[model samples]
Target: MGFDTATTTLLRAILDEVCESISRHETGVRAHVASKILEAATKGEKTPDGLKQIGRAALSEAPTMWR
Candidate 1:
């Protein structure tokens, strides 16, 4: 399912915030964070704070090798 512009923008912002400490080269970690946020959104988590929390959790759960 596709998201509207606003939702997309919000998700992107949250991804950036959550991945800020992560290197851009760490595609695995970034993809992991993005997928988790998208998963949460698909499950009806549209709020910024909620999505951010999910993103943060995903980041923390990312492969240790990537971190």
Candidate 2:
């Protein structure tokens, strides 16, 4: 799906915020969280709070390699 520039920008910002919140520096983990947030955005979730919730939820559920 082709997202307009605004939505694309919003998603990027949201993803960056989520990654920052989680203190995630790994490229793979960041990409995974970004993809999850993008999926939510594509599904019509637009609010930053809602997107952040989705991202945090995904992070909480994601398996830890070291754990």
Candidate 3:
């Protein structure tokens, strides 16, 4: 199993943005959303309600950019 540099970079960037966003959501990422995201991530499934997406949305709504 191997990942190209581009994929690694993209993942890193997304994670960075997601983390920053999570730190700022007033409503917060609920336990259920986190759980679903974790499960999908662990299983390597295509995330339906992806945490990154939700996080970025919250971030964009507030004070961050998902760059």
Candidate 1 lDDT, 1-67, residue by residue in tens: 9999998999999999999998999999999999999999999999999988999999999999876
Off by over 4 Å in 2: 21-25
Residue-by-residue lDDT tens digits, candidate 3, 1-67: 4446764464545555565535434334433334444444555744433647754554445432322
**Best TM-score among the predictions, by candidate number:** 1
Question: Candidate 2: worst 10 consecutive residues by lDDT?
Answer: 58-67
CA lDDT of every candidate = 0.93, 0.80, 0.48
Cα distance off (Å), candidate 1, residue 36: 0.3
Q: What TM-score, computed on C-alpha atoms, does each candidate reach?
A: 0.95, 0.81, 0.36
Candidate 1, residue 39: CA error in Å?
A: 0.4
Candidate 1 versus the native: TM-score? 0.95
Compose the digit string of candidate 2's lDDT tens values, residues 1-65: 88999988988888787777555556667777878998998889989899999988877766686
| lDDT for position 29 in model 2 | 70
What are the RMSD figures for all models against the true structure?
Answer: 0.7, 2.2, 8.3
Clashing pairs in 2: none
